[model samples]
Target: MKEIDFSKLIVTLVQPLVQEPSAITVTERDTERYREYVLDVAATDVGRVIGRQGHVASALRTVVEGARNKHINAKKIRLVINDHRH
Candidate 1:
């Protein structure tokens, strides 16, 4: 299987769950110890992506962490969702 790009996948995962897909923006930053993915979405759609009780956000993080473990070594990756709708 062709390995997936977790950052891109993260963006794809969130785009559909949001109300304004065009407002969705993902930024990737790499550091010596970790890779950071910043997920930006409209405030109106923040609740939808985060889901009830944060289940959605947790799941998204889990998947990305899993993938990061498979590819990255001791280094790690993190997902940060930024909602600026309000």
Candidate 2:
């Protein structure tokens, strides 16, 4: 298991799908049960990241979770997408 930069990974995966690349932001919050990654994108790009029927978002979460599971860590990881009108 190696140190994984989940925030950077998310940003890299999402940057191309957004119109305002500079507005993309990823933040982390730690809880007793899990670590949460909050992804904020320009309001207009939200749909792009989410994709139709939320398939893209689901896929993104899958990738992130898969990586986390590969490492031997007790804490779980969560991905949250938020839209902002920056």
* Highest-TM-score candidate: 2
Score candidate 2 by lDDT: 0.88
Candidate 2 C-alpha lDDT tens digits along 1-86: 57788899999999889899999999999999888999998888999999999999999999988888545767887999985543
Candidate no. 1 TM-score: 0.78
What is the Cα-based TM-score of model 2?
A: 0.88
Put down candidate 1 lDDT per residue, 1-86, tens digits, no spaces.
35558767887888778779988878888888777888888778889988999999999998888875454345677888886653
What are the models' TM-scores? Answer: 0.78, 0.88
lDDT of each: 0.80, 0.88
Error at 3, model 2, angstroms: 1.5
Clashing pairs in 1: 43-85
Q: How far is candidate 1 from the true structure (C-alpha RMSD, Å)?
A: 2.5
After superposing candidate 1 on the true structure, give the runs of residues whose Cα lies further than 4 Å from its correct spot: 1-3, 69-74
